[model samples]
Target: MGADGGTASALEQALSTYLAHLRVERGLSANTLAAYRRDLERYLAHLVASGRRRAEDVTAEDLSAFVTNLRTGDDGGRPLSPASTARSVAAVRGFHRFCSAEDGTPDPAVDLRGPSQARRLPKAISTSEVERLLDASSIGDGAVPLRDRALLELLYSTGARISEAVNLSVDDVDLEVGAVRLLGKGSKERVVPVGSFARRAVDAYLVRARPELAARGRGTPRIFLNTRGAPLSRQSAWAVLRVAAERAGLPHEISPHTLRHSFATHLLAGGADVRVVQELLGHASVTTTQIYTLVTPDTLREVYASAHPRAHD
Candidate 1:
C-alpha cells in the first residue's frame, strides 16, 4: 500500500518528513539531528518488522516492547545503557508525537516511560586546579595565548557552554558593565555578570591581541578567532581546553562543560541561591540547576557538624 510496495516505505516517508521538520522548523543542530535520525531509524525498523505500517496501527504496548528490547537487546544487538536507552526513547517519543500532531493519529508513545537512570554528579575541578588551568592558558606572549586565556577565563567565570563561548561576537560582552549576553538553547538569551578577573583578561585580549588576529583573515565580529581570523570552531575550543588541562598536569580528562559544572558547583558551595545560579547558567528551569546542589554534600556535612549540637553525636 506504499510507493515501495510495503508499509515500511510509508513509515520511511513519514520519518523523512519529520526529520525535515526538525531541521527547518525546530532548528536542531546537525549533531542532534543525526542522533535523532539514528534512534528513530532503528525504532521504525523494529516497528516495520512487527507489521506496524501505519502510525495509527501502532499501540502503546508496541512502544513499551521496543523499550524492553533496547534494554535487554533481545533483538540480538548489544544492549543499550540506561542513558542511551533514555535518549533513544526520547527520540522515538518525539517522532510519534510529531506524527500525531501532523495527521491526528493516536500517539503510541504518549505514555511511554524510559528506564530509571542513576543521576551522575557533574565533574568539577577544584579552585586550585581551575587557577592552574587558567594560568596555563596564557603560557606564551602572543595573540594565541592571550585569546586562549580570555576564552578560558570567560568560560569559568560565566559558565558558558562551549558552543555559546565559541559562537560569541565582540558585541556580546560589555567590559564597561562587566556583563556578557549569552544565547542559549532554543535561541534564548540571558545576561550574566562577568567577574573582575575575566573582564581584565578579556580586556587585554580585545585591546592587544584581537586586532592582530583579526588582520590575518577577511573580517568577522566573532570574539575568538583562529590564526586565519576565522571564527573558532567547537573542536578548536575543545582543543584549547585539552591542551590547557594537560599543561596544568591534570590527571583526568576534562571537557569544556567541566568548567560550566565547576562554575555552578562553586556558586552553590559559596551559598549562592540555586535560582540565581540557574539564571547565570541560562537554564530554563531551576530544577536543572538543583543538581549542582548535590555536588556540595561535603560542604553541607561540614556545616551540619559545626552548627548542629547533635550532629557529631
Candidate 2:
C-alpha cells in the first residue's frame, strides 16, 4: 500500500492475481506466465528504484520515463540491448492492461509505445556444418565420444530445446520407432521423430556409455548422464555443444538453439507445411513458427540473384 511496504510486495500481489487470470481465464501456458513474472519483476524493480512505489500511483509520465530508462540505462553498468528493452516495454504494457481490468485502476501504460527494434533473423547452421559437428563428436572413440555423438545428433534431429534434450528419460526415447517424447516449454509433451543417425548414436550410448556412467551412482531413469551418472545439466549441455562446434571448426559464437533454427529452416526450405513444423517445434501458435518464412524469402532472393539469366549484368 505504501512505499515502505516495498514496490516488490505490491507488484508481487498484482502479478499473482494477473497470473491466475492468465492461467484460469486466458488458459496461458505455465512457461508464458513464468516469462510474465520475470518481466514484471524487472519493471517493478525499476519503478521502485525511481521512487514510484505503488501501482495505483503510477502515472503515464512515470511509465514513459521507465521506458526511456530501459532504452538508455546501463543494467549494472552494462548496456541493455534494444531487443531486450522492447520485450520489457511489452511486458509492462501487458501488465498495466491486466491491472486496469482486474483492479479497476487507471492504466498508465495505455499510451506507452514500444521502441522500434531491428528485426534480426534467427541464425542457423548449414547442414554441412551440422554434419561436421556430429562427426567430430565421434572421433575420440570412447564413452565421451559416444555420449557427445548422441547428444549432438538428437539436438539436430529433434529440434529440441537444449533443456528438453538434456532432461530426457530413457523411457522417453523409442529407438525402434525412431521417436522421442520431449517435454517442451510449459511441460507440454510432444513426440518428435528422430533420424536413423540419431537413433543409432543413442543406441550406442545406451548400450556402452550410459552403463559405465550409471555405475558411478544409483541408477536413474535419465537418458543423458554426466560422468558421475547424474542427469546432465543445461550448462554442461551448452559446454558440450560449444566444444563440439570448436572441434568441427565451426563459428565460435554458435549456440544450441542454432540447431533448432536450422531444423526449422531446413524443413521449411524443403516444403514442409508450416503447421507440421509448428507441431515439431512445439509452438503453441503458428505465428511463432512463421519467422522461418522470412528466412525462405531471403533464400529465394539469394537463389534468384545467383541463377536468374538476366540478373547478372
Candidate 3:
C-alpha cells in the first residue's frame, strides 16, 4: 500500500460495503448502484486528497468543504453541473450514515442538508414536434416500423421511464381498457391510461410486427422486442428515440425522457392537477413531481412586460 492507500482504502472499503448493503439489503437497482459507485469514487478520492484516513475522522467542516470542492471544481478542476454536485453530496451523506450505523462513528454528514440544486426544468418538445417525431417513427421501411411507432407513442402516452417501458410484458398492457401497467422505482406498479392514438398504434404493432419478432424467441412475453426477438433494452429504446427525433428534424436532445417530460408538461399546461400528474408519473413524492410546475421565467417576464399598464407611452 502507498502512503495514501490506508486512508484511501478506509473510504474504499466502507464504500464497497455500503454499496453491497444497498444492492443486497436494500435491493437498489443496478443503474442506481452504478451511480452510487461513481459518486463515491469521487468522494473517496476527495477524502484521500484531503488526508482524511480514519472512519471516525470525517467532521462536518470536512463534509462541507467536500461539497464546496464539488461545486467549485472536481478533482481534475473541471466544473460539475449542479445536479452532479448534488448527487455527489447525497452519496457522501448516505455513506456517512452507513458508517455511523455500522461503526458507531459520529456522522457529520447526517445533519448537513447538502447543496441545494435549482430544479432544472425538463426539456419538452412542442406538441407539433412530438407529432412529427411520432410520425417519423412510422416512416422506416422495416417490418418493425409499427413497433417503432408504438414504442414512441407509448413513451409519450404513459410517461414511463424507458427502463420501465422496455421491461414490460404483454400482460402488462390492457388493450381493451387502453392502459399500460408500469413497474416503477422500488417495483411500485401503476397503471397509466394510454390515449386513443397510442392504443391504436400499439394494437397495430402487436398485431402486425410483434408476431414476427415473437417467432424468433418462441413465445417471449416482452411487449417490445428487438430484431433478435429479445426484450428491448434501455439503450436500444434510447437509440429508437434519437433516430426518430433526427428523422423528424428535431433537436439532438430529444431523448426518451423528453417524451415523458412532454407528457407531464403538456398535461400541466392544459390544467391537469399537479396531484394527478404525480400519480400519472408514478412519483413516490409529489415533491419529486413538482419540478414540472415551474413556469418559464422568460415567458412570464415577457407577458408582464407587455401587459402592464405602466409600459412606455
Best by TM-score: 1
> Candidate 2's C-alpha lDDT?
0.83
Give one digit per residue, the lDDT tens place, for model 3 in 53-118.
865787777777777777787566566777888787888888888899998878878787755666
Candidates in descending TM-score order: 1, 3, 2
The C-alpha lDDT values of all candidates are: 0.91, 0.83, 0.84
TM-score of 2: 0.84
lDDT score, residue 303, model 2? 68
Location of the lowest summed lDDT over 10 successive residues in candidate 1: 1-10
* C-alpha lDDT of candidate 1 relative to the true structure: 0.91
Q: Which stretches of candidate 3 lie over 4 Å from their true place?
A: 1-10, 72-79, 111-116, 296-313
**By lDDT, who's the top model here?**
1
Candidate 1: residue pairs that collide: none
Model 1 sits at a Cα RMSD from the real structure of 2.8
Question: In candidate 3, which residue pairs get closer than 3 Å at backbone N, Cα or C atoms, i.e. clash?
Answer: none
Which tens-of-lDDT digit does each residue in 1-313 have in candidate 1?
2433567788888899999999888877788899999888788877877888777789878888889999898866568999999999999989889999999977888889899999999999999999999999899888999999999999999999999999999999999999999988767789999999999999999999999999998999999999998999999999999999999999877987999999999998987889999999988899999998999998878877888999876
The 10 consecutive residues of candidate 3 with the worst lDDT sum are: 295-304
Question: If scored against the real structure, what TM-score would every candidate get?
Answer: 0.90, 0.84, 0.85
Candidate 2 off by > 4 Å: 1-3, 6-9, 16-38, 49-53, 74-79, 298-313
